[model samples]
Target: MAPRKKKNASQIGSVSDNLPHNMGPVPEIIKSEIPAKALKEEPIDSPLPDSPVAKELVTPAKVTPETKKKAHKYKLNYEQSPFPDHPLPTPEVAEEVHRLLSKEHGQRKAPTKVPPPSATKSGCGEVPDLLDALLRTVLSANTSGVNSAAALQGLIQTFGAVNGSPNWHAVSQVKPEDITKAIHKGGLSVVKGKTIKNILSIIHAQNVERRDALLREKVTGEPAGVLATSHLTQIQKDAEIARIKENPLTMAWIFEIKKDSEIIDELLKLPGIGVKTASCCLLFNMQRPSFAVDTHVHRHCKWLGWVPLNATADQTFNHCDLRLPSHLKYGLHSLFIKHGKTCYKCRANTNPGSADWKKAKDCPIEHLVDRELTRKPRKRRRIEDSDESEGDSKVTSVKRKSSGSTVVKPTKKAAKITQSKPVKATPSRPLRASAVKARAQSSQVKDDSESEVEEVVSEYDE
Candidate 1:
């Protein structure tokens, strides 16, 4: 193979000119928006720093080389792909959105906002109870924050051994129909109730399997159910610690994995868990850097042109999480939600006539998004009514002349164009009866002359 030639400066410049307008590294203007001073300051006081440089400097001593490789998988660049093409939002747009939104909503402090003690017990930087996170997130689906909270409260009130303790043990024993009646106020009670029961059943079954496996290895003589209480005094505590641990392996624990592939597979198998739900669990519960795409995020992503217009919520989630840096995921997710709710211009649809729409036209980020595609409802009017109709007139009725006298304006010439009657096309001239007969006689004479000429030629040839 021949060595490849290096491109000339002009050739490189021409190639770049052909690239999409948005395709390039993040612009300097966006970079300058987030100052070096601000980037250095940690939002929350912690052992580790959020800044990429600082994070590398203070890398955890326990993070093995294998863990480092696992982390690299999540840091994959999703913007460019060879096997399959996928569209993703540019870093500059994400940065711009973050900067503007953070100015309005403020940056999210690390040790992400925690739920109440009843909802969660994990301290800052620790993994949350997966079951609690799953149930709470499931309740949050397709409902307002207030309603989901109420539903969660109702479930605890009914199934919890005491008020604050979400006793999964007792919950596992409860009947499905009974669970349904308890969570009736959460909306989609039947579905949610069945989901909760199914999750509990899955956990219980997995726990039983783990216990049976422990018995086979250590407590060989004991029966399956009895192994839960079976004592293995002879075994070294360190030798059988992982296998003999009493806590059952549930889907929540499954999400603790560092590998994205395994975690995704296990999450999708559970009831009511989609890409959004799974990503949320990974971010909040597992303290991973996965980004979830809800309605607000999806709408903003589309408006920012980070995602294609027809991209689904799940596709947006995958595209974003894979491409976005780990540190920005949490803050950007919050900002997207905040901006989507507050920024009228970035909203999915807005009426042009609305006061909010008028105000949003001047938004700073207007140039960044597809401003022309702002959807507005067309005015309903009768076609039978002429444009000149005083009742149907859309513009201002008042007109002023140089003399300072106000007068009611008459309709323009264009207005009467629609009201004017349309003209019919003129008919073509028809051939008269005498003209037709004379034309036919001339044609016969011409044919007879041609036949005589042919006969004279044949006589000459003979």
Candidate 2:
């Protein structure tokens, strides 16, 4: 077996044909191993690991000059809003509306002479204290202005300090029954009392936060030169902080917030404070520009077309604040309230046809009133006759003849004319049968024609 037999040429060719063709040289996977210490010695991309760092490294991956230049020149281009919810009034229209209202309301004249310091308008008109106005506004809800004022007076009288002013700290500490009894003059006493207490608690919490923040700075060994009570001793500072917590309405921070919108937002965080109440505080107490929308404001704005017909009272408030300038908010709100009370048509539950509305024919904004006075269509009432005699008399009376002749008798009038007097039976000429048949046929045709005409007319009316 020293020499092996040579393979056939055909077998070698078949094996070669089955082998893979067009194969490229495979690359070798060679991984270099380095020391662990070398990896630890490498520097990180960022210097401060805990600080807020940009995701992009200082040395960005290589980029083209054109890309880098374009990136530097990038800017945001914002498009104007396409859909606006509130209607924007022309300056002329606004001026006209204001003029008409001012003319009727006496132009909001200032005091002609200095009155005694004792005389003062309360609530939203002349109340300057933020917390005082807030409490008064809360009392005003769902009640008349007079009742609200009386309720506020009752509360202050019950809980007022020896100095004859409301002691809010004492009020906060009083029992719920005391709060309720004091504010019973205002409707919804139980609910309003809880809201008052809650508001006080929130304010107290804020005051505590402010106190802690100040004390924290002191503990940090921070310099006190910038602190509000830096000049006062530590004991005095504590007293001042205590006073701030007690009389939260007089807190410096409440009036320091510049934006009326921001102030309104803060007030909304308190219990019993709504948009109307907050806005009232902003406009009157804070003397800041804010639009307070109430039932009157809502109705008037809708009539003036500043707000849409479907807009709710809250929506009307936001819409007016956007469309009307800030300066006009206070005056317009006051005037609208006055006008709504005096205007016959503007009063609650009054419409154009009401007797009181007739007196409002000369309304100041008559020209600007775009809202239509729509009255419901009256239904057509059916009139029913209650007389029984009239209904019973409709039956027709029939008479039978003794003669061997069967004939339908005519009405009383016709019978009276044909046989007015009784006639002796002289075998007089019998009534012509043809005439009787003709008369019956003609009457039936007349009755059918009348009925057909009536049906046609009724159908046409429908």
Q: Mind giving the per-residue lDDT tens digits that candidate 2 earns over 1-462?
A: 599889777545544345367342344557769644545577645434334453345643433344443321112111211115454554566667777888888675323332221111235534545666676677778887677766677777787642333577788887777888987977898998888888877777777766776677668867444234555576766665676766654545666566565666677778778778877776766666767888888777777777666666666666666667666676778888888788665554455543455756578787777545322333322111121212323322222223323333344454565587774544423434333443344344432132110101001000
TM-scores of all models?
Answer: 0.56, 0.58
TM-score, prediction 1:
0.56
Put down candidate 1 lDDT per residue, 379-404, tens digits, no spaces.
32121112134553554233323343
Please, what is the whole-model Cα lDDT of each candidate in the order they appear?
0.58, 0.59
Q: What is the C-alpha RMSD of each candidate to the true structure, in Å?
A: 32.1, 20.0
What is the Cα-based lDDT of residue 375 in candidate 2? 22
Weakest 10 consecutive residues of candidate 1 by summed lDDT: 453-462
Model 2 TM-score is 0.58
Q: How high is the lDDT of residue 214 in model 1?
A: 55
